[model samples]
Target: MSGNSRYRILFAGTPDTAVPSLDALVGAGFTIAAVLTRPDALVGRKRVLTPSPVAARAAELGLPILRASRLTGDAGRETLGRIAALDLDAAAVVAYGALVPAAGLEMPRHGWVNLHFSLLPAYRGAAPVQHAVIDQAAQTGACVFQLEEGLDTGPVFSRLERDLQPGETSGAVLADLAVSGAELLANTMGAILTGTATAEPQRGEPSLAPKLNQADGFVDAARPAAAVAARINGTTPEPGAWALLEMASAPAEEAGERPAQQRVKLLGAVPEELPEGTADLPLGDPLPGHLHRGRTAVHLQCADGTVRLVQVQPAGKKPMSAADWARGLPEGTRFQAEATAETATEGP
Candidate 1:
């Protein structure tokens, strides 16, 4: 068969990050036999049912769609049967959110190809891009690999690398990768159809990047300023990094009364560096968790140094400049100190 349209294939994905690859495949002239995505989920405060981004896009493109929360038991059998009926030459997966069954793996002649955010044999698992930022990785990129049952342990077909920029959030890096990775996915698909694709075993030691939870987003000032900055940026636009702001008690209140605490999301964080000859200024170094507000900005002291809070979002409020938020703070107000033991650490 000649040309991409001659090869029938299935496209499986979910989330906004996966939409680009689906579009790229269609633009590359692939005959997308069908699209598989997760079932509609309850989203937002109202709990309205919402279709996955891929499912919604597939609907817009007028392509057949298969929705499954998971491919297991009877649902797995039915979906697999339906997929098999398409006589697919191969399948392309990008953040599909679920694992493919062993039976489904053999249905495609060229097997299933996955577009993972991180290079193979390194940072393998869900949340690769997030973990890469948190761990301060020098570089990270995308890989198109043959998918098996293991957790991102697959032979690679093609790969692309990009350097991680300082102070860049995981969300920003992932968004960039999603676009560039879409092109990589489409090229790999074309190569596979033309029988020019080569699969090679992954090299180097492996690292795990498990999914992060709400607790992972807690920003502890006890850690070094760089680590605190990394954690805050890595968790941004998702679970969201936040710190506890302690309110000062009134002067007439009981001597031993505890201060009230408010949760505030730390949207933009970066290590602060004092200008030359400013060391002798009255601001001298503040204790960890203490706030130092200047005319133009607000800085929070950490273990080694201080981090500038560029933007902050108070509970139930929109994000605002740290300087604006600090203007109304009580004289003794500061961030609540968190125990180092409660902080989240990267897995080996």
Candidate 2:
């Protein structure tokens, strides 16, 4: 705790990513008047009611917790009143999920400061990190900005940049950003208290990163191998990338069964180079969607090249290595490419 103990701030966020910022603020010695997170919701296969990650962490910190899904309805009025009573100097938000209404925004003297995961003016919606990974960006960063009614369109106080590692998934990048960005948020708060904080208008061509859906996770083999690999990595661990596996025919034990069309999730994938001296061979140039099962790995042919499947999860089964999964498949098994309305365009 520093001399900044007198500053009372409301912490608003709801995910594991937000937990770090909350912890940082408390560790930095500011008074956390209360924590605002979404209400508990059913989670996992057991349908157990689960608090948001921030709520759970706040409980461990013995901090007051206020759960609300939104700040605009009748229930929101009650939440707003509760917030107003706190007499907060400012509110810090990180992946809060719900938008703050105009009335609620006015409750804090310094307004709300948000820690957004992307370099604003670009990837400015719900899925910034995921969209950046899917777009195969060379670099991406986080920004601490003033939260306004406009969608992440406020002036930024501070930012930190990190280069995208080769083959890194969105989940991995975000986890790292959470920790570094937490420090940034804490420092920004310190600057705010000392009257040294400065925010400038964002400068860049704005781009949108709308929330990704199940359809966005569909892996189309008609795309180039690099694109397919990017999509798999981008959506890993959430609405996971998947494709329909079309078996050549039923096994001898189930001879009468219709050719199996199983939906399988691709857990790990990467573009691969063909074996030495085989780059120009027909075996190395498989048609789109063709499955080439090698001795230890399973490869899929894409529009321009081959992508190796490192891991896969069959419906109703736990994830397994692609080699292990491919060993049991019948010959001529291949991924079925679904026709999509639009293929993913290049760049962010």
Candidate 3:
């Protein structure tokens, strides 16, 4: 790394978002020792074998690739030997799914670095962007950290912050942070090559960002509208916010054992106040998820207030505006209040 030649960097990544970091390092004139990516997998409609996004990019760049399915046991040692053979100055990981065993971590003289989304010690795990938006964080960013034995528990070299704009979806926030973090990672590498960068142990209240799943996207009506709105924002374009609206007015014959409720995925929503008298209600209003139909928009009473639906997708149908979904609903239909609310907190 101290030589006159360009620093040799081993890049490990799998997804599309991680491509920017690779590009940044290459654009900054770093000689990528080799690219490490996940093995090809069956993807899409026909289930054809397809390379990961990073792998595709590495192919385009004509970089050497190390396809790893597991980085443990004999495989880990083989990967370590490969790293040693490369004589890498350092290795950078961005959303590399597999764990980097200690052998791989210690192989690079300059150490293994990770470009993690979210300011470290907070939202540190697989799904930081989703958790940040779910927690309604005003601002979140990226950090470059030395990958150690712990899960994202490492010394931080640099940090960059991005504002969480109003109604921004998790996907949008991640996209923005990817670009900034890619730039930060490249700069951090440049500084390290010059022996100017320093890393300190992470501080503050640490929180876990566990992987998000379909269950995490449920919009439980028993919770306040803002909380439901958070789910919509955080879950968009993935396991999108889903709920079951009850058709109270529909006859049993019409329903015909249709499970009483219809499933809907919320693509867009805005937490807002219920109109006029509906907001006041009785002191102990019993119906929390009562549907309130409007001419142009659809409003529904919630635990604390109401939510105006923007866009949604019903089961077996294409995505459509909330107003359109509401128009198709039977009269006096409402979303059933969740029997039990999710007790999990987003983050510290």
lDDT of 1 by residue, 1-348 (tens): 337888898999999999999999999999999999999999988999999999999999999999987778898789889999999999999999889989999999999999999987888988999899989889999999999999999899999999987678888899999999999999999998788999999999999989899999998887888888888889987779999998988843476777888999998688777434423236655556888777778888777777888799999999999989999998778887675433423222
TM-score order of candidates, best first? Answer: 1, 2, 3
What lDDT does candidate 1 reach at residue 329? 91
Most TM-score-accurate candidate? 1
Q: How close is candidate 2 to the true structure, as a TM-score?
A: 0.92
What's the CA error at residue 203 for candidate 2, in Å? 1.1
**TM-score (C-alpha, index-matched) for candidate 1:** 0.93
Per-residue accuracy of model 2 over 149-260 as CA lDDT, tens digit each:
9999999999999998656778889999999999999999889777899999999899999999999999988787788888988998676899988888647337776566
Model 3 whole-model lDDT (C-alpha atoms): 0.83
TM-score of each: 0.93, 0.92, 0.88
lDDT tens readout by residue for model 3, 1-348: 434246889999998889999999888888998999999999976999999999999999999999987789887778778878998899999998988888778888888999999999999899999999889888899999999989999999999988886577888888888898999999998787789999999999999999989989988777777777788889886667888887764457476754377888888678887666543234556466677666767776767667887787888888898877777776557776664334222211
RMSD of 3: 4.0
**Per-residue error (Å), model 2, residue 29:** 1.3
Candidate 3 C-alpha error for residue 2, in Å: 15
Q: In model 1, which runs have C-alpha deviations exceeding 4 angstroms? A: 252-254, 275-284, 340-348
